[model samples]
Structures are given as structure tokens and as C-alpha cells.
Target: MSIPTGRQILRLYRDLLRYGRQLQFTDKNYFARRIREEFKQAKNTEKVEDINFYFQRGLALLKNKRVV
Candidate 1:
């Protein structure tokens, strides 16, 4: 598997942030902070497979949220 480039990771992060804004939660700040924290924790990850898994998992979770 090819290593993901910096741009790809950045794009995924941005997309997650954007999608996170659509979450229908009472505490928007808390939700946003959680998302930021999750991404930040993975910032230094070096494995491409692990990164891809996280990206997909994050996207799935965001997609599952109801936009109320």
C-alpha cells in the first residue's frame, strides 16, 4: 500500500471538520472539540493502513449522524 501524502491527510482532516459541523448535537463546541482531539491524537501516526482505517472510521461516523 502506498503511503498517504500530507495533502491527503490534510484533506481528510478538513473534510471531517466540515462534516462535524453538521452534527445535530446540543453542545456544538464539545462535539467540535472531540473531533479535533481525535484528529490531533492521530496526527503523528505513520502507518498508512492505520491512517486509512481511521479516516474511513471517522467518515463513517460522520455519515451516520442525523442532521437535525
Candidate 2:
């Protein structure tokens, strides 16, 4: 699998920050750890048509306020 770019990773990180902000009960640090775990998993997977798909999924989860 191809290594993900810094920009893509940063996008995912940005979404995570936004997601953390939306939470009322959970600590931001916990939410960030969750996002980081998911990113690590995605980076270990096989290559796909678009690298940004992972970030898109994360952003969608943030938009819906749902965990992976």
C-alpha cells in the first residue's frame, strides 16, 4: 500500500478536531486517540483509487457525529 500524504493525514486530523468539539461528554484527547487509531488502520490497508476517501469517511463521521 502507498504511504498516505501529510496533507491527507492533516485533513483527517482537522476533522477529528472538529468532531471533538461537537462532543459534550467525551474528552478531546480521547476523541483524538480514536481518530488516530482509525487513521493508522487506514494507512495500513491496501491502496485504492483515492487517498482522500479515508479522510472523506472521517469527515462524514464528524458531520454525522458518529464514531467509526
Candidate 3:
């Protein structure tokens, strides 16, 4: 997929955090903290490849973590 726009990235971040809270077996706080730390680490990403990579990674994470 094309690199995600800023708004899309923000939405993904929010979704990840929201999904983390719904985890039944995992620790939600740790999941949330990791998601926050990951986004913070990626905050300065400027390269298109890096942005795309993170965007795709986030999508995969959300897909895997989301509760049905």
C-alpha cells in the first residue's frame, strides 16, 4: 500500500492503543506502553520508506491484535 497520510497514521495509532485495551490474556498497560513507545520512536520518521514500513507494520499489528 501507499505510504499512509498523517491522519491515517494517527488513526492507526489510536486504533492500536484501543485494541490493546481489549486484550484478554495480555497485559493491557504493557501493550499500551509499547504502542506509545513505538509511536514515539517513530515520531521523527521522515523517509517515505520508513514511514511506509511503520504504517504497514501498524496495520499488521492492528489486524493481529484486534478483538473480534
Candidate 4:
């Protein structure tokens, strides 16, 4: 797979944050924190293929939830 550019990664990160913000949960803070943590954990990932896999998975989940 082609490696994603910085701009693409930034865009996806923003989109995911936007989606997280729109989530309707009882504990919005917890949801937000989890989103933040997950992203933070993935921030240092070294493999482009792994990042792409995660990006695609996240996109699929967001699309399924009608958030994208």
C-alpha cells in the first residue's frame, strides 16, 4: 500500500476527532479521553501498513456509524 502523506494523516485525525465529539454517550468525557488515548498510542506507530490498516478500519467504523 502507498504510504499516506502528512496532510492525509492530519485530515484523518481531525475527522476522527470530529466524529468523537459528535458521539452521543452518557460519559462524553470518557469517550473523548478514550479517543485521545487511542490516537496517542498510535501516533508513534512505525509501520505504514499498520497505520493504513488502522486508518481504513477507523474509516469503516465511522462510515458504518454514519459519522463520515
Please tell me which predicted candidate would have the highest lDDT against the true structure.
3
What TM-score fits each model? 0.66, 0.57, 0.87, 0.73
What TM-score does prediction 2 earn? 0.57
Pairs in clash, predicted candidate 4: none
lDDT tens digits, residues 1-20, model 3?
Answer: 57788899899999888888
Residue-level lDDT tens digits of model 1 in 1-68: 56666787677678766776765754667767877898889888888788888777765766775433
The RMSD of every model to the true structure, in order and in angstroms, is: 3.2, 4.1, 2.8, 2.8
Model 2, runs deviating above 4 Å: 1-6, 49-53
Task: Please state the error at residue 61 of candidate 3 in Å.
Answer: 1.4
**Residue-level lDDT for 12 in candidate 4:** 73
Q: By TM-score, how accurate is candidate 3?
A: 0.87
Better of 1 and 4 by TM-score: 4
lDDT (C-alpha) at residue 56 in model 2: 65
Candidate lDDT values, in order = 0.72, 0.71, 0.85, 0.74
